[model samples]
Structure formats: structure tokens, C-alpha cells
Target: MIYVVKNGDTLEGISRQTGIPVWKIVYDNQLSDRNVLVPGQALLLLGQGETGEVSGGRAAGGYAYPFIEPEILGQAFPPLRELLVFSYGFTFEGNLIPPPQDDLWMVETAWNNGAEPFMVLTPFSGGAFNNQLVKVLVGHEEIQENLIRQMLAAVQDRGYAGVDIDFEYVLPQDRAGYAGFVGKVRRAMNEHGYRVSVAVAPKVSDSQRGLLVEGIDYAALGENADTVFLMTYEWGYTYGPPMAVAPLDKVRQVVEYAVARIPPEKLVLGIPNYGYDWALPYERGITRARTVGNVEAVEIAAQYGAVIEYAPIAQSPWYTYRQNGMEHVVWFEDVRSIEAKWGLVKEFRLSGAWYWNLMRPFRANWLLLS
Candidate 1:
């Protein structure tokens, strides 16, 4: 069972509530400061030895840029079966534009760490993802075939186990066109003994709308590809209001809706490995939140003497502190919060979970999933 830290809650208080001892709570979460219990921390009522032995294997993957920090990359590779190298873009003329950063090192690193590296194919032109570029490629039969031909060849040359098609920001009119493109890619790749996966924006229903989400037809994509990765995080975003990155209530709604349309086994729930810090008073058009790793968030709480607080409804940890004559609010994930996510995987009997990108160092998450 998971226990949420309430106001005025102590280790002994939690012990009495759950009938577990104070030492057990301390050991499970690896609490460095036992005396300082903050509101909203989720406590897993199990010991270190007990967790891994029982919860060892669950299918998991993570996205990573070609240039990952050496220290952060070392701890992440062991936990993923597939590390999606982000990404390989395509041109309007049907030529593959590979990642700017060399990915040979990442491919080799995945192999050394017992993971099967996969290539991420995206629709990009010049620099960023272009909906017009996607519409042009998918609209023409010859261009689609040409792109797939090059993609398969690249996969063969790189020794990638498969590909994850992550075409983003597609227009609403291009929904069926994009779905057809995915189906063609899957058929061609499957013939070469390569699997294809697709990432879809999270939605609670077919009627849900926002931020280029209309282009996603969840049911169609689920049938087209080998698996579907639900982009479940980022309800709180860079330009959005302060909130949980992946609020539990919101994530559950997406998963519930997805399973009704797609097979539960084919869904990989996406979790955020990092969080954002927003300077208060937030401005609608101008405010931008700087990204921070989960471990770093806690350290900042300690450094500034800010008490970390949790939102029960969101199942997320956050805190407020003043620095340089400015107030800031941070919402981030911890062991308790992630364990709640893990429970959803079991509750739904879904395939597994994956992180957005493994750039940050979150040792507790590494320990939990490892």
C-alpha cells in the first residue's frame, strides 16, 4: 500500500497509521533525513530487499538524445530493453536526414548494456517538425516508398532491432493520411524482421482536443504499429500553468481511454524523468520554466530551506522557495509518485512504462525500475 505524507505527519505518525515501523519507512525510500517529513511524500511500505526481488521484470524503454551525459547514461541503459535514439528526420523530397549528433556511440552503448537500440523516425524539414512536410510525404506513394526504402536500409546498416515512428504536430486533415503511412511502414518493416512502434499524444477520448492532438487516431495507430507509446506526461509544460508533469488523475484517464480502443499490452505509458521550475507571477505568453532533474529538486529544497509539499490529487511533489528576490514553484516526481504510476501498469496489466528522455540523473527512479 502507498501512504501519502500529510501535514504534521512524522515517521512515527506514519508508522501508527500504516502499522509499519519508523525504520521500515526510512529504509524503503532511502531517506537521508529521517526527522524532516514533508507533506505529500508518498511512502511505499516495503523494504529495499523486498522491492526488487518481487518487482524485478517489467517491460520498459526510454528515449535519449545522441549526446547524453556520461554519468547519467551509465545508470539508465541497464533498465531499458529499447533505447530510442532521438531522432532521424525526413525531407519533403523523401530523403532521410539523420540526427545532427553521431549516434554510433549510443548504439554501441546499448549493445554493451544488454539493450536493443531502435531508430526514431520523425517528419522534419530544415530544423523542426513540419506538418506540411508530413502531409507531402504521406500524400505521395512514391515518396512514402522511397522514405521507407531508405529507413529499412539504415536500420539494417545500424543493426537496430526496430524503429519507432514519432511524427508529431500533424494537422487534423492529415489524420487518415498519416495513419496510412504508418500502416505501410509497418508492413514493409515487418517483412524485413524489424518491428515498428508509434508514439501518440495523450487524450481522454476521441472528442478531446488541444495542441495538435486532433491528428492522432489512437485506434488506427494501435492497429498499424507493433506497439503504441502514450505520451502521458507534460500536462504541465514550459509555457503552461504550474502543475504536475504527470498528474495521477490525468494519466489514469488517458490509460483508461486508450485500453478501450487499443490492446492494453501494446500500450507503453510514458513518464517524465525531469520537472520544471516556474518563477512566480506567471505570465501567459512570456513565462518559461527551466527544467530540473528530480534529484536536484530535493537538493534545492534543502539548500533554500523550503519544505517540500505534495498534492494528493496529483500525487506529485512540489515546493516553493524565494531566491534573488523572486519566488519559484517546482513540481517533480519522487519514489512514492512513480510507484503510484507503476501500480497503474499492474492495475491495467499494460505492457510497461518509459521515460521521456534519460538526460537527467534520477538515482531513485533508476533504483526503482532497475
Candidate 2:
């Protein structure tokens, strides 16, 4: 069971209310400082039927970006504690851009919540993947070594459990260099008692051609990093056609290909926690989809009297509505859709599922995870 911490609530108080032992709560959450309780903080009070034991063959994880608000973090802390890793970092320009001072609270809070905190290192610039950064890093041996050294230093300084390499839009010619970089980083980090994970684009075949697919050599990366987060979502993007963010068929194909090359135990299926609402009559360049929270999508359906519909093939929930005399369609995850995706974890024998984000309040999703 999950309990949200209210004002003036203490661990002892919560134990009294939930009939769970104080020591058990502290141990399960790995709470080092019991006196520091924030409002809206979520506490997992294991009940009679709940084992709080993860399946040996599977694990669960999520990505918590640097910009998440404290209140959202409080609410998400409970379920995230059960996850294997809570990635709390983002992509920077081969440098570690410290999160805003205010966000440091989340770092401590995450540790208290029992999730192994990971830092994400990426080659993104101004909201898009920068190809030039990848080129510079891969082409210059000295620069690559220096950057990896700095990264390991940052991880050590920040007390992070590991680092996630999220370099995207890498040049196809640098495939060998990319794998080489990961191998070097992994070897160094292993010596330093840190874990290394890599994020790769969803690919159905080794021969898949694309800027995203070409740079990532699955077998080499799998051999290097401890875990590989397969980004299986985003088929329906902000500027694309209206459809499921992570259509089941597409996700399955990626998993099938991944398990063939990467060990199933080291694969983490990416699950999108949010969805998109696109206006009808979408034009390739003119139309843009507005991102909506999973719960907000339902409220939208109710507000507009739109009838929610389920796409059987996609295993996702969607609805159409009219606002300002314009037709709009929304495709988002519900309990049913999320549960269906969880089934894939077992079907593919994957390590677990990793949520794209935890900024939104999806009580149903949390309950399903519980």
C-alpha cells in the first residue's frame, strides 16, 4: 500500500496509522534521515498480500528528469523505490551541467526513497540531438578520454550509482568509435565501483538505416554496458500523425530484435508515461501535438463529452473530442494499456520496464505497478 505524507506526519505516525512497523518502513525505503519528511512524500506500507519482492527475472525502473517539481517527486517516490533504478540526470554537451540548486533536494530524496540514482550523459543541444558533438568526441581520442574521465569524476562527486550514455544522432561512420567509447567508459567505471547503462534507439533489424539506428551497435553496446534501455516509444511524435506513442506491435518487434542480440536480463523496455493530443486534419508541418498527462487525458474526455476508444492492435486508449469547433484526437495510456505492456516484460523475459518520466500523477499506473 502507498501512503502520501501529509503535513506534520512522522514515520512513527505513519506506522501507527498503517499498522506497519517503523523499522520496516525505514528499511524498505532505505531512509537514512527519518526526521526529514516532505509533504506529499509517498511511503510504501507493505500489506499482507504484497510481497515487495521483485520477480528475480524482471525489474522496473524510470527516468526522472532534472526539471521535475518537488511535489511530483514526493508523490512518485513510493513506487519508484520499488524500481531498480531512478535515472535522475539528462543529456548535456559532453559536460556535466549541474541541476539547479533547488533540484538538489530531489537527489537526497531519491536516495531516501530506495531507488539507485543514475546520471544521464547525452550529446544534446538546444532541445535537439547535436550530431557535431558526437563527431568531435568520437574523432578525437584525447577529447573522448578526457570527457569520460570528467564523467566518472562527476558521478563520484555527486554520489550517483552510475551513468547512462544517451548520445543520439551519432554519425553512422562513428559506429565503431561509439562502441569503443562505451567500452572504455564501462571498463573505467567498473573499476570505480559504478554501473554503466546505455540508451539506444528502437530498431527492428541490425540493418535498419537511420541516424539514430546507425550509430548504435547493439551487440557491442550490450557487451559493454551493464544494462541497455531500449527507447521503444515515440512512434506518434509531436509533429507526426495521431497514433499510439508506443504501439504494441512496434515495441514487440524492437524487443524481439533486442533479445536476439542483447541478453534479456540486461534489457529495460522504455514505457512512455505521457501521451499526445493532436488536432484533427493534421498537416505534416503545420500541425503540432500537445503533450498531455495520462490522467489529464481522461479529464479531457470528460470535459468535452468525448467517448474514449481503445485501439486493440496498439493496446492503447484514445478518444476524439471537439473544442473551438475543431476536432482533436488523444492517445494515452490507461490501466489496460499499461497492463498490456507489462505483459510484454514477461513475454520477452526482459529485465523490466523503464518509464520515460514520472512527472505526471498517474495514480492508476502506480497502483498497477504496486
Candidate 3:
């Protein structure tokens, strides 16, 4: 669970309210001064739970919707054992809708293929960070109750075996609220015989505070949600400096901290089937958010006549090409990088690994995991 410090809220008050040990919070963030917490800071609240080995071997999974266009769904279903539906959420104005038509086909195809369909829910589209939405969906009592009811109804009507809530950019203050939301959702889904899961940021400790890390209360999620999916990708991304998609050390830091709070069996590591190419001489104010999947990125490199180079630290492939005399760096995942990440999943004994939006056709990724 996360505790965002308000202007007047104190660590003592938060600790008292949540029943979390104060030392753990301080130690998790590695703070030199315990008394200093910004207004939007996030703190993780660890709870007692099962800890140890996950004996299961690596398993394959995919994210999709059942209602994709006939051609798309037909092309997508033959790949794997698990199909994760995109979402079911109220719009910004607050009206509940079913998954998109394209997604409906994807979900149906997974079922027909004898694959389990997992439904993922989010408050925002395109993975933007939204704190106010998190507060309303999780902090506000009325909204939380309504969301839980709607979630249960959707799972039953759609015949989903499991539900994955992927709420991102939550405010620091809504830490407990998010935890409460997970608890309520879990209760509603479990009573109805539905599996409940949550998507969390990759963090090693509970006290970590950053816009991305603050929103996810890893410990609370570990205790409340049936499965905690750690997004272990994007170490190298479009908006940030050029780097590998999922570096080995960064992933390990997240897993090491996560296991201390969550059971290894419930952890689902995220694998990136994608990569980013950043234009050099980067401008601060300008936006550079073009991210490409592995297949597309590889083709882009070939098109530019860019020779691919490998980074041992990142364990991913990259190449620098000049376009109209401007320097650009492209970072992408390949067989070697995917294998390194998969090795981490095996070492951690995680429940499984999930890909982010299987919109791209990366044949090699499936082959490597299979």
C-alpha cells in the first residue's frame, strides 16, 4: 500500500492508520532522512504473506481482445495459451462500455483456442499517467463501490477466468485508496469465482518515490491481488535517453525488492517485444514518443542500411544511423535480450511473464519462449 504525504499528514499518522512498520517504509526507499516526505511522495506498506520458491517452469502468454477484425484475430490466436483482453472501464465522463469490437474477437479466439482469457482494466487509454483518476476510482468511496460492482458484472457476463487492473500514474496520497480498491475488487471477484490480478511498476522497495513508482503500492498489491504483474520492460524508451528495452540489472533490482514483499508465485514479469529509436541532439521541450516493436524496428534498421550493434550491459541490439545528417540511435530487443529476461523469470520462480499489447507480430519472441 502507498501513503502519499499531504501538507499536514505525518509519517506517524500514516503508520498508525495503515498498521505498517515505520522502519520498513524508511528502509524501503533508502532515505537518509526519515522526516522528509514531499506532498506527493509514495510509500509502500508491506504485509505478512507467503514467501519462497515458485516451482513452475516458464509458461507462454499473450494479450489480446476477442473482437478484433476477423483477419487480425484469425492471425493472432494460434500463438499461445493465455489471451488477455484489453479492458472494460468507464470513460473520463464516467460511462461503462464493453471491450472494443476488435478486442471482443481476440478474447473469443483465445477461448476457442483453448486458451484462458484474462481481462485487463485501466482508467486511462494509451498508458498515460493519471493521478486524479486513480483517486476517484480508488479513493472515492462511491466510485470504488460502483467500479467493483461493474467489474464483477463484466467478468460474469463475459465469462473471463481472471481480471487484471492496470491503473497507472496514481497519486501518492491515494496509496491506501488504491489498496482498498484492490481489496474490494478482489473480494468481489473472488466471491464470484473470478481470479483478480494487478499490474505494478518494477520497484525493489516500498518507499521508492517517482511519478511512475509512486503510483504503485507494490506491497499492498502483493498482499491483496491474486497476481502482481511487474512491468519489467522499457528501461530504454522513446521519451527517455536511448538504452535497451529491458536491462538485466534494472529488472533484477525490481524483482529483488518485489520478492521481499510479494510471493514469487504471484509475480508476472513483463517482457518487451518492442524497442525505441531516439534522435540525437535531443530537444528538451519537443516530444519524441515514437516506439516500435521488435519486428518493425528491425525492418526500420534494414531500410536505413543501419548495421545493428549489440550492448552487453543491456543485452539488446541497437544501431546508430544518420538521416539527413541528423544522428539517431535505435534500441531494440532481439533473441539474446529476450533469453536474458526469460532467464530472470526462471531464476525468480515467477508465476509467468506477460507481453505488453501483442499488436506486433514478433515470431522470434514466441519461438524463443516456446
Candidate 4:
């Protein structure tokens, strides 16, 4: 359960309202100051006959770019079982492109902090997902084998525990070929005792069609990998109109559609560790929103004297402020959003969470799972 802090809400006030002791609340969420509460901030709740740990144990994974600040990365890994190193892209000819920053330290650090590291393989080139490059690899059987071998070799050289296939923007026509490649990777990795996972675009049904959704055959991919990460966030994005990044209703629809085809336990819920701040009067194709950390978003609200409000439908927190005589809006995750999302994970009995690039300081997020 989650308790949203309100305007003028106190820990004592919350305790009285929810019938839980204030100390337990503080301990569970690791709140250093119970006297201070941000409006719309979500808090975990525990009542009689409930345990915080999910039954049958949960597997938590997260992704992080090699360039994440050392301080932030230090705080991000203790609760995670796996750390997916941001990426190793490939060219049309199947040559591997390593992460820009030296990743040896990153991989070693994750292992030291108790999370096994996995190499992330993608077809991202230049700046965005390269469909043409992905097409080249998926269309040819020889190139697929070469790419897979290079990936496995790199993972082995780095002592990585596994590899995560993260091909995106695959054309709809190449769906079967993509799935076949994933299967081949999974089998080869399994033989070496390294598990394979895949990050896929969320789909509400098999027939859902779009640049992002059309190429994803969720059921087929589910059968091809050891674990599947449903990228359930990003309904609200950088250039698009402002909205919750991961609306609960939207995530649920994706989960519902997913569990019918994929084994629930094999699915990991993909969540965001960051949020977006959009300068409004949004003009499509022109306006770009700046990504903000969840903690930073709250600080922005406070700095601007903005009062955060809860959008109950989305089960997310948002606020608006004026800057340079222009109104701005922010949609970000808070304690409530985490509880709501993890609640779904528990309800559906999914594997656990996989947070996208942990570059921000969202302390309460890790505290909840801890």
C-alpha cells in the first residue's frame, strides 16, 4: 500500500490516518526527517499480516550508462541483482561498437557492489536506433551469427554474467528473423551458463501497430529469451505533450496483454529512474523537454513554489510552474508511483523491476525494494 503526502501532511497525521506506527513508516522508507513531507510524494505502508518482501523472491535488474556519475552509481546497485551495462552497438557489417566510456571499471564496480553485469547489445548507431543497420543483420543469417559470436566473445572477455539483446526500431517485416536471432543468442548463452534477456517495446495486443510496437512480437520474443523486460514507461516523452511517463492504467493494459502470452514470472517490469520537465505551450516537432531526476523534480517544485498534485488516474505526480513568463509542467515518479508500479508487479507475480539508466538520485526508490 502507498500513502501520498498531502499539503500540510505530517508523519503523525499520516500515522493516524493509516493506522500504522510512525516509526515503522520511517524505517521502511528510510525517511531521515519525518517532519518534512513533500505533497504528492508517495510513502510505503504496512498493515497487520503483511510482509514487504514478495513471495518466492523477486529478481531486480537495472540498466546504467557507463558514464553515470560514480556517486550516483554507488547508491544504485545494492538492491539490484543484475546491472545491464548501457550498450554495445553494431554496424551493418556486424562489427561491434563498444560503449563510449571504458566499461571495465563499471562492470567491476557492479560486481563489487553485488550485482552481476550483463553486456547490452543493440543496433543503435549515430544517435538513434538504426533500422537500416538492424535490417542488415537480421536479414542475413551469416551476419547474425557473426554478431552473436562477437557479442558472446566480448561478454566473456569482460567476464560479464550475460548479454541483453536490445535491438529496437526493427521493421515489422523482420519480426521473425529478430526472434530467431534472439533464440540463437539465448541457446548459445545458456550453453555457456550465461542468461539472456531482451528489452522490448510494450504492446497491448499482437495487432498493435506502430513504429515502436509493430516490430515487437511479445509472445514470440518471450519464447526466445530467458527473461523479457516490458518497457512499460515512456507514454509521456521528451518531445511529446506532457503526461505521466508510466501511467498505471497504461502499464496495466500492457501487462494484461503480456501475461496472456508470456509466462508472468519470466517478465520483468521496466520502469523509469528519471522524469521529464516540459516547457509548455508545447509545440510539437520543436519543443524538447529536459529530463530531470525524481529528486531533482521535487526540488524544482519547491524552488518555484509549485505545489505538486496527484493525477489519480495515472497514479503519478505532476506540477506546473512559470519560467520566463512561460508555463512549464513536470511529470515524475515518487514514492506513490513506485508503490503503484511494484503493486502491479506483485499482483501479477512478475519477475521484478528493471529501471532504465540509473543516473539520478532517487533514494526512496531503492529504499522501497530494500
lDDT of each: 0.84, 0.76, 0.69, 0.85
Best by lDDT: 4
Q: Given candidate 4, what's the lDDT at residue 365?
A: 70
Score residue 272 of candidate 2 by CA lDDT.
96
Model 2 lDDT, residue 215, Cα: 83
Best by TM-score: 4
Q: Which residue runs of candidate 2 sit more than 4 Å off their true CA positions?
A: 1-57, 81-95, 100-103
Model 1 lDDT vs. the true structure?
A: 0.84
User: Which candidate do you rate higher for TM-score, 1 or 4?
Assistant: 4
Better by TM-score, candidate 3 or 1: 1
CA lDDT of 284 in candidate 4?
95
| Candidate 1 per-residue C-alpha lDDT over 1-370 given as tens digits, one digit per residue, 9 for 90 to 100 | 5566767888888788767788877755557688876555556675435443112477778899998986678776466678889999887889998899999888888888898889999876677778888889878999999999999999999888889999888888889999999999999999999999999988888987875688999999999999999999999999999999999999999999999999998999998988999999999999999889886787677577787787889988999999999999999998878877888888898888878889887655655675
| Ranking of all predicted structures according to lDDT, beginning with the best and ending with the worst | 4, 1, 2, 3
Give the Å shift of residue 80 in candidate 4. Answer: 0.9
Give the TM-score (vs. native) of candidate 3. Answer: 0.78
Per-residue alpha-carbon lDDT of candidate 2 for residues 1-370, written as tens digits (9 for 90 to 100): 5565666789889888888888777655445466655443345567545653332335567777666766765665555642222333323234555544443455567788877777777665665677777777777877777777777887787777777888778888888888888888899899989988899999998889988898888999999899899999999999999999999989999999999999998998899989999998999999999999886776676577666667889988788889999999999887667767878888878878888888786654554565
Tens digits of per-residue lDDT, candidate 3, 1-370, equal 4344566666677778877667765543334456655443334454443111121345557565544445534443344666778766665444465665645455566788867787788776554545677776664677777767776776776777878888877788887788878888888888878888898877776677787778677888888999888888877766777777788888989988888888998998888867787888767656484788676675665466666666777767788878889888888776557667777888988877887757665544553343
Alpha carbon lDDT at 303, candidate 4: 70
**TM-score of each candidate?**
0.88, 0.82, 0.78, 0.89
